[model samples]
Target: MTQHQAADTVVIGGGQAGLAAGYHLRRLGIDFVVLDAQAAPGGAWQHTWDSLHLFSPAAYSSLPGRLMPPQEGETYPDAAHVVDYLTDYEQRYALPIVRPVRVEAVHRDGTHLRVETGAGNWRARTVISATGTWWRPFLPAVPGRADFKGIQLHTVEYRSPADLAGQRVIVVGGGNSGAQIAADLAYETDLTWATLREPRYLADDIDGRALFDHATARRRALDEGRSDTGGVASLGDIVAVPPVRTARDAGLLKAQPMFTRLTATGVEWPDGTRADADAIVWCTGFRPALSHLAPLGLRGPRGHLLTTGTQAIGEPRLHLLGYGDWTGPASATLIGVGRPARDAARAIAALLGNA
Candidate 1:
C-alpha cells in the first residue's frame, strides 16, 4: 500500500536552509515536512573534509534563537562542530524532518504541489526549495580527462588530507576550497592550484576583526545595487590590498593558468605549461540541482529557477529560501536562512487559510 502524507508546506533539502524553514513553519503552526537526502542534517558541511572549518567567525555564524557554543575570540568552527550544532538545533526546535529520503521530483497539480521521494509521495499546498549552493559540484569537461592514469576527483569526494598524503596533488579552481586545500596539503605533498583568473588573496583579519565583515558588506552592496559595480566580483577583487598581497607572499600556494588538456600522468595548461600529478581535486563549485524539475517551466535562461522578484515565479505556494539576493548574506549562510524561512512559513500559512 502506498502511504501519502499531506502538509501545509514541504521543504526540500534538509540542510541548514531546510531545517531553518521547518523550524519557522512549526512556529507558524503550519504543518510541514522537511525532506533531505542525507541520513542526518548539516547539508554539505556533513560531507566536507574532516579538517574543514567555516571561514566566518562564530558571532556571524549563529542561527536565530540558538547561538553557537561560546568560543572566546573570533574563531571559525570546524565541520564536525557545525554538524553537532545543527543536530542540536533540530532537537531543540523539534522540527519534523524526513531524512535519507531523496526527493526525486516535484510537480504542481492545480493548487497543490506533489513531491515524490524514495521513501514515499507527499502532497502540500506549498513547497520551499532550500537546497544549498554546493549540492552539485561543477567540473568542467576537459579533453583526455578519462585517459588520465592518475585519480581525478571533485571536492565533494574529498574527506581529509590523509587521502592525499605523500601524493603530488593538483587542486583545480581558485575559490576558497582550492586555496584552503592547497594550503592544508602544503606539509603533506607537492600542491598546485590552477585557474584562469589570476589569484587574489585576503588576509585572515581586517582592522583586528575577522575579514568576513568585508565580504558581507560587499555582498550587501552588490545585492542592493548600491555599489558602483554593475555585476558581482570575486571576493579577492573586493577585499583590501594589504591582506591580498600578504597572502600572496606567504608562498604556500601559487596559481597556474587554466587547464587545456588532460595527460596520462597529469594536466596541461594553456601557455603550454604542464605538470605531473598523482591526484587532481576539482574545487570548481556547484550549481542548483533542479534537473528533476525540468518538467516544470520554472528555470530561467541561466538555468536558475526564475523567482517572482525573490519569491516563486508562477506558483505563490512555492518559495525558495537561501537563494542569493532574496534576503542578503543570510541567503548564503546558515544563520541568514532564518528570516526567509519565517517569511516562507507565513506565506504557506496564509495560502492554507485561504484554501
Candidate 2:
C-alpha cells in the first residue's frame, strides 16, 4: 500500500524556479507543496564544486521577497554562500518543501495530476514542472572511449584544481564552465581547451553590473516588442577572460579544433592534430530530464516542452519558467522565472475562483 498526499498545486523541483512558483502560489492563497529530490533546498547549486560561484551579483540573485546576504562590495557569492542563502529563504518564507523525495513519474489522471515519488503518491489539481534545465549532464559518445587508458570525467563530477593537480588535462567545450576550469587548472597543469563553436561572447563583469542599466532598458523594449537601441550588448565579443584565452596566456592551454575521434592513447582533432592527455574533462553542458513526463506528449520535436507562447498548452494551469527564447535573454535567468510564476499563479487562482 502506498501513502497518498494532496495539494492544489505540486511543484516538481525545489530549485529557484520551484521556490519561485511556491512563493507565488502561497501569496495567492493556494494550497501547494514543493517536492525536491535533494535532502534540502538549493537544487543543483548544492552539488556544484566548492569553489563555484554565481556570475551574477547578490542583488540580481534574490527571489521574490528573499534577498541574499550582504557582502559589502563582493560582486559574486560563492557556492557555499548561495546554498546558505537558499536555506535561509525557505526558513523565512516558511515554504512547505518536501525534501529527498524523488519523483519517479508524473501523469494526468483525468483532471488531476498524479506524481509517484519515493515517499509515496501525491495527487494535485495541477503540477508545475520547475525541474530546471540542468537536471542531467550531456556527454557525447566518443568512439574508442572505453579503450582509452586515461581517466575521463564530466564537469558535474569535478570538484577543484586539486583533483587534477599535475595532470595533463584536456578540457573540452568552451562554455563558461570550461573556461573557468581551464583558468583554475592553468596555474598547476597543462590544459587544452576545445570547442565545437568559436568561443561565444561573455560580459566582463558577469555579475550583471556591467549591463545592469542597459539590461533594464532592453527589458522594456523586449516587453513592448519595440525596436530600441542602447543597452548592455550580448557577451559575444569579449573573449579574453574566457577559458581558452586564459589558459593560452598561462602557457597551459593549446587551441584544438573540434574533436573528431578518440584513440586508445590520444584524441584526434578535426585539423589532424593529436594530443595525449592524462585526463579529459567534458564540460559539454546539460539537458532537462523530462523522461518521467513522457506520457504527456507535451514536448516539441526537440524534446523541449512546447508552450503556447510561454503559456502552457492544454493546461493553462501549467506554465514553464526559465526557458530560453531565440530572440531574447528573459528566458534564462532567475528574474525570467518570476514572470512566468506570477502569470501561472494568477491563472490558476482565477481558474479556482479563489482570486
Candidate 3:
C-alpha cells in the first residue's frame, strides 16, 4: 500500500531465473522487488542432494554477467558450490529481494497485480514468476502406491545416501537425478534403477556445455525461420558425470524397464517377478510450481498454462520462467535462464514505460 512497498515489477522466486531477471531489471533501471520463498539465497539448489553436481563445467554454468568460478581442480561445481555462487550473485547487485516470503496467490487488482504473501502484499504493474518446479516433485499414481508398506520418497526430500545403507532401494525415473542418486546409493545399498524407457546417454565426452551450445544454436535457427538440423541434445537426456560413469563401470547404472506396479514390499515386473525393496525413491521429476496463479484460471487440461514467448497467453502482465523448455529453451539451467530472463525484463520494462 505504501509507495516504497510497490514496484514497477515484482519477481517471484529468487533462484537462477529470478536472479537473472533481477540483474537485467537493475541494468534497465527498473524499480522492482524480488520475493523468494527460501530462507536463504540458493533457491532449489539449497535443497538438492548433497553430492549433486552440474553436468556442465563452471564456465558454462553461470548467471547473466559473471562466470561461475570453478572450484579448484573441480570440473563441475557441486550443489553447495552453486548455492554459494547464487548467494553472492544476489548480494553483488543488491537486488531488492524479500526473503522467507511465501506468496499465496496473484490477483488482478484493477490495472495492476496484487501479490498476496505470508510476509505482506506487494502490488506491481508486472509480475514475473521464476518459481521453478523443484517444490512440486511428482510421484506418479502407480497401482498399489499407498498399499506399498515400505518407505517411499521423492527426490525433493532425499538429501544423502548415508541413510540408505545396506537396504534394498529402487531409484525410479531415468533422468540425471536417477543416475546420480543411483550411483551414490549403489555403494551402500542394493539399488535398482527404473525408467519408463531406456535412458539415452550423450556421448561420454559431451557434457552440458556442448548440449547447451547445440540446443541454443538450434533454437536460434528455428527462431530465424530455418529448419534446424543437427539437434544436439534433449534437456532430459542424462549426462555421464564422473560418478555416473564410474557407476556404469561398476554395473550399478543398469536400469530395468519401469515395473507395472508397486507391491506391498517392493515392485513387480510384468513377468510376475518381484524385487524386495525397503525404499523407493521416485525421481519422476516435477510439474510447474504455478499453484499460486490458480486464481487466474490459466492452467490447461494438461496442467500447463498457455504461453507465447514467456508471457502467459491472454495475460500479458504475467511472465513465467525456469520450469522447462516450454517457458524457454533450457530455462531450468543456470546458464540457459539468462536469455529468457533478459527478454522478460526487457518486455516488462517496455510495458512499464521504463524501456
lDDT of 1 by residue, 1-355 (tens): 7777998788888888887787777777887888888887688788887666665556567677788784444266777788888899888998888788888888877767888888889988888887767776787888988889998878888877788899999888776677666666776788877876886655434321234344456655765878633222433532323322344567766787878999999888778778898999888878777765665677776567777533677667778777565433446676566666676777777778888
Q: 39-93, model 2: which lDDT tens digit per residue?
A: 8777778887666666566877677777777556555677778777878888788
Query: What order do you get sorting by TM-score, best first?
Result: 3, 1, 2
Which runs of model 3 end up more than 4 angstroms from their true locations? 1-4, 228-236
lDDT per prediction? 0.72, 0.72, 0.88
Predicted candidate 3 versus true structure: per-residue lDDT over 1-355, tens digit per residue: 3432688899999999999999999999989999999999999998888889998888899999988999877888899999999999999989889988999999998888889998778888999999998988888989989989988989988888898888999999888888889898989998999999998877789887787777788778888999865555444478889999998888778899999998888989999999999999999989889999999889975678899878999789999988877788788899889998998988887888842
Better of 1 and 2 by TM-score: 1
Count steric clashes of candidate 1. Answer: 1
User: Which of 1 and 3 is ahead in lDDT?
Assistant: 3
TM-score of 2: 0.87
What's each prediction's TM-score?
A: 0.87, 0.87, 0.95
**In candidate 2, which residue ranges exceed 4 Å CA deviation?**
1-3, 203-206, 209-234, 237-254, 323-332
* Number of the predicted model whose lDDT against the real structure is largest: 3
